[model samples]
Target: MNSVQSLIQPQVLAQIGFAGIVALTLTGALIAVFPRNILYNILGLIVCLTGVAGIFVYLGSPFIALMELLIYVGAICISIIFAIMLSRPLHLSLPKRALPKVGLALGVGAAVFIMLSAIISRTEWQPAAMRSSDWSIATLGAYLLTRYNLVFEVISLVLLVAILGAIIIAGYARRSPS
Candidate 1:
């Protein structure tokens, strides 16, 4: 009963959610990269950004997660979609994959993987002698309220200005004689 209860706990649920988010992110990234269609790529990018917001939540920053969703998906992706709509359409006939290019890509990937593995295996990781334990949620909250408050406010102001600028530019483009 206790084991079952533990499995249904918030921590376990969060772990499952994290795994799902990671899967979602990877799927979106694959879709974004593999598809030739511009619209599909943009949609995939939105999905991927949403998944990344989930990841930010998993990493213990819901504020960052919300900001990520708002900035990337809400602002950037929407702007991109609007731009796509306004721009001249590229005739997107699918091209056949070349065998030599595929082979060369695979070869390079394998070489990079092997090199990374060798470097990682050869390296000895040692913790810093004076590593600080100042990464607690309490410390984070305190810092946000105190030390980083001005920085946060400045960033928020900048983002607001940027968003307004983007909107104005977009609107101006619409109003201008094409």
Candidate 2:
């Protein structure tokens, strides 16, 4: 037990955890992007978002991590899955990918990557000026409720409308046999 404990120190464990999180994020992103199946893509997105939440937690922001999980994974991904499942039959064969379009996408992606890399390398990163340290959950909730309540309500309404639309479409799809 002592030997095992010595071999797996806190610093080593932390490094391993960080590496695992990064690997998860990358793998999930690849899965999301490269898969042809919509269901698989959604699952990959969930994995990627979960990995991002893990990274936020690792960076010492548990609130942001929880919000990421709750909003992206729980609400958005689930809603997407529900819509996809109800809208169409999963067994239908997807059309083959066009080579020219794939090539174009790769070229565009590479260009964007190079541009972002150049911009990031040339930019001087600076820490923000330290403000009041009252970043408690209660304080954040109060601020959101008081100042950003309209934005919050608007977003909620949008989501509600989207969900309702999805339900209506699903119902219509079911009734009209293709």
Candidate 3:
């Protein structure tokens, strides 16, 4: 339709898209941090991560974006969901929120926010004169394996241990009475 075309100019559309992505990211972050439900928090985190991936695409690195999607949204969230399923009933009663605890948390959050805002506002930001804009997955993998091999290995071992511990816990739970 002419109306649709009129509203969707390419350059303006790109800026609108960026704004929408930023809105999505902020909305997700707020939902993740402020919600009472654990599942809602996880879903919000996924949304935030998806928005971050879109931002990475805007920044010219789709590989990192894909990894962000695969690792955080796919693997981590799925594993967390499985863990929740294995450990607790869907109808488990949530603990009542204590007012004093919530007030303390809010005070801490406010303090951190003010401190960070001041730091960020005062700090200077400048782009490097020469920066490599490589977005290749192969290059990223090579760098991780070569330069950050120890970190990669440690993370792998940690994941392995976590998976094994989950299995053991599940096995024990299965043998016990429901």
Candidate 4:
């Protein structure tokens, strides 16, 4: 087959896959934020995060994709669900939306989106003078330990505190009548 035909074949398939992911992400975010059902919102957030993890995979960071699945999908979502269970029954309906604030929020979101798009289109992104040829997991791990050691340690400490705080909060809430 000709180069043009080969390019078109793969490009079309890639575009289709990208569109599917975009749809999944948007749909999940809509369901998460707009739904009155908390359980549905949590499920939608999980779907959205999964789509994001897939995007990370496509961006050539399988490590980040796995970390996203481990931290967000495994830990964060489960913790949120536990907090939801502790705080409120699934049967309870959320309060009605305030139409004025909803309109304001939509307007702000649209403005921000337009501004960001304009800025991105106008900017020229330049690579470093000497780009590294290595994109290996070993290099990433070394960077995490050496160059980014402080950030890595801080994040671990933060996660540890979050878990301890969640446990304390749940304990306190349990002791008090709601």
Candidate with maximal TM-score: 4
For candidate 2, write residues 40-86 as lDDT tens digits: 88889999999999999898778999999999999999978877776
C-alpha RMSD values across all candidates: 5.4, 3.2, 3.3, 3.0
The list of candidate 4 runs beyond 4 A from truth reads 1-9, 172-174
- Tens digits of lDDT, candidate 4, 24-103: 88888898888888889999999998888878877878889899989998999998898788667653867789999999
Using all chains and alpha carbons, the TM-scores for the candidates as numbered come to 0.61, 0.80, 0.77, 0.84
What TM-score does candidate 2 get on C-alpha atoms? 0.80
In candidate 3, what are the lDDT values of residues 1-178, reduced to their tens digit?
Answer: 8767866988668888999999999888888877778788778988998999999889888877898999989998888887777668752655678889999999999999999999999989888999987767888899899999999999999989987897788665558665
Instruction: Tell me the number of clashing residue pairs for each predicted model.
Output: 0, 0, 0, 0
The most accurate candidate by lDDT is 2
CA-lDDT, candidates in order: 0.85, 0.86, 0.85, 0.85
List of clashing residue pairs for candidate 2: none
lDDT of 1: 0.85
Put the candidates in TM-score order, highest first. 4, 2, 3, 1
lDDT of 1 by residue, 128-171 (tens): 98978665678878998899999988999998998899888866
The better-scoring model by TM-score among 1 and 3 is: 3
Which scores higher on TM-score, 1 or 4? 4
Which segments of model 3 are wrong by more than 4 Å?
1-7, 168-178
